[model samples]
Target: MSDALSEAIPVLLVAAPILAATLPLVFGLRFDRAGWLFTTLTTSSLFVATVVLATVVYSEGTVIHQLGGYPRAYGIELVADRLSTTIALLVTGTSAGVLAYTRLGGPRGNTFYSGYLLLVGGLLGLTFTGDVFNMFVFLEITGLATYALIASGDGPESAVAGLKYLIVGTVGASLYLLGVGLLFMATGTLNMIELAEAIPQAQGGYENTLVRAAFAFVFVGFAIKVAQWPVHAWQPDAYQHAPDGVTPLVAALVSTVSAYALARVMYTVFTVDFLTQTPYAREIVITVGAVSVVAGSTLAVIQRDVKRMLAYSSVSQFGLVVAAYGLVTETALVGAVIHLVGHGIMKAGLFIAAGVIALGYGARTVDEYAGLAARRPVVAGGMAVLLIALIGIPPSVGFVGKWYIALGAVQAEVWSVAAVIFLSTMLTLAYSARLLEKMYFTPANWLEDPHAPDADVVATDGGSGPGLTRQSDRARPDAVSIGMLSIVVVAAVLAVALGFSGDLFYDWLEPFVSEVFN
Candidate 1:
């Protein structure tokens, strides 16, 4: 492909979704169900474009499209290197895949899909934009769209969760913006590549109080965005109460991209040399990640709500990624990226499986999952595979990422973080085993006959005229679609299949990692 065409792809990839976001709402007056179709089409095309862009990037090197042909010093740039394109693929492909579930299992409406598209656009921009300030802009766009989508749920709880996320997310964005302002004051630029060149030449180099404070603000901001411990109170409520259709997307891509942004700022804007010279910078990052791993896993073990459990699991998983960032070795960086991708895939599948089970069997809690293997065999089987993968079982994607990270920690001789990785694995096993026992071993005594007029009623005498009846508030089972089942199965297959691709990922990421470290 010509350089011009390759450059145009990023523009199209970012703009297409934002522009198409309006189509569903505009057409809703005449066609009520247009949102799904439009989203499916837009995301599908974006995925194809990303693939083409990826080919060009791998073949030609990083593709930089300076907006309106302006110079890098002043113009906003969109970059498609090995790292950004990998994340772009994840964002677009997952956005397309989740539409299948939403089509039948509603939170359906033109407005819902509009917010969905807007979220996708924001994530893409976040992935591709090469400016520090624009990153904050995209961050806020993503947050607003997420808040609206979370609030689209049927219950008032969804609204409350949305409000909580909004307040917390805004604080995160504000902190990030303040960090960007500090960077500007220190370096006189907003572009990432420019900031990278200028930061070292600034007044005090790495020790500049302005530069250190900027990193501090940026780090804390992303800690909240990524739901690290002590600041993660918003995540469980948001994930647990979000519309079933919305949870998978937010859980999978939102924080994954935020972590990616954090890494980008660390390496691309600040570079590795600054980190090496700066006192306590790397240590602080590693400590935060290690602490989150322990705290998040401990919290997850006590959660009865399945969705809430997974939310906390994310905190633990992402903690590993953050610690890998602080390790500063090539292997750790590779491991971090792989883990980010792996966790996103696994969590999306788990949440989708949760949605499927809730629809087909009306089970939501850990106890409610008893005998799930018998009731919804396919979904339960898929969920089982996902949970096992998440526990770092061998020959699975989860194990692949964790193995790299553990090896990286040992290579760097960060023994404390290494031990934390092992501890997290055991803790993850605890909760996963609880669910596994419930699904496969425990009997479903709470489940009554499908034909029973009152599903909650128990006939004390087996057929007596007046038996004692039990009262319950759970919703009745709704029909599950084949499409929903297929998504879960595909996610399971990919999780295991990608486990064998560790070497391939390392090779693919080598050029980018080499550039940053060198």
Candidate 2:
């Protein structure tokens, strides 16, 4: 790629989706089917752009693009480094993949695709933005688009869920803004790299009241945004009540990116040196993450609703990431990034599988999964693979992340945190095994009467929002597409395939980590 092309890629990643988002709504005035095709094309193009950007990042190191002709210190900049590109790929790839599910699965219409494209743009901007204030702007954009998407479901419940998310998400954003304000007060710059330089020179070094308060507010805000335990009440409702198509996108990327942003803030902005210099900073982060791991898993194991269970599972999965961050070692941070990507793919696949099961087999709860393998072998098998991966079984994406995180914990000699990391595997299996057993070993139960009604109705409405479908619509297999199934299989394959590439990921991250840590 030429220097100019390489420089333009990051900006294009954000701009393409935003510009394309308008095309669907405008083109809809004349053609009804424009949204899906346009959105798919746009997402696919963005994916290619991300791939190119990744190659540039690998060969040339971090790619920085300053807006207009302004220099890095004063102007808005977009950065495509190893860390950002890894996440940018996940955001773009997953958004494109989920379109296969959304195409025939309802939530159709140009307006819905408008929100979809906007969400994609927001996520990309979030990944690439180089300024703290610019990050906050992208964060709000992401939150707004996400709220609208959640509310686009068919039922009143979805609206309520979206509103709840909006309110809680607003508070989190406000706190993050407040933290940014404090940092600005302490150091007159809002640029992340500049802030990193200025923070140590603040009134009290790491112990400065302004800097300490800034960290506290920023950490708390992200804890809420990432859905850590105690502050995670909004997540279950949002995931469970959003349209099936929306659930996977939100599940896979929304919180995942927020967690990524938190990592960026901690390391890129605060730096490892800050954590070492600050009193009890590492302990507080580790404790919050450790407790979230235990609490999230315990809650997940007891939930009857599969979506809600998966929602709680994210809480635990991200807890592992957060804990890894607290470990503050290169291995642990690398593990955190790997886990973030791995968990995103695994959860996306799992949710897509759950939707397939709900739509194809009318199985939404654990009990409904009895003998699922006999009825829908491919989906059942795919889901089973994802679940096993989630349990951190060897040679799976889940295991590689956990292994490094746990190893990092042991190396740090944070014995309790390490214990939580190890114990998390068993905790994950507690829920995973229940679904696995029901899917494979339990005998199929058939209705005695061919005309018997379904015990529970799973509705698939035409509108863009989420609600329980009526039994007749829920069990219709014709609505499910082969493309959707293929995406699930692909996600499962990647989860396992990426596991073997852990060392490659670690080495790719070495230069980035060294730049930050040194």
Which one wins on lDDT? 1
Error of 2 at 227 (Å): 0.2
- What is the C-alpha lDDT profile of model 1 across 73-103, one tens digit per residue? 8899999999999999999989999988899
Q: Show model 1 residue runs off by greater than 4 Å.
A: 447-454, 457-478
Number of residue pairs clashing in candidate 2, backbone atoms closer than 3 angstroms, sequence gap of 3 or more or interchain = 10
Query: For every model shown, what is its TM-score relative to the native structure?
Result: 0.96, 0.96
Q: What is the Cα-based lDDT of residue 47 in candidate 2?
A: 97
Q: After superposition, how far is residue 70 of candidate 1 from its true place, in Å?
A: 1.3
Worst 10 residues of 2 by lDDT: 449-458
RMSD, every candidate, angstroms: 3.8, 2.7
TM-score of 2: 0.96
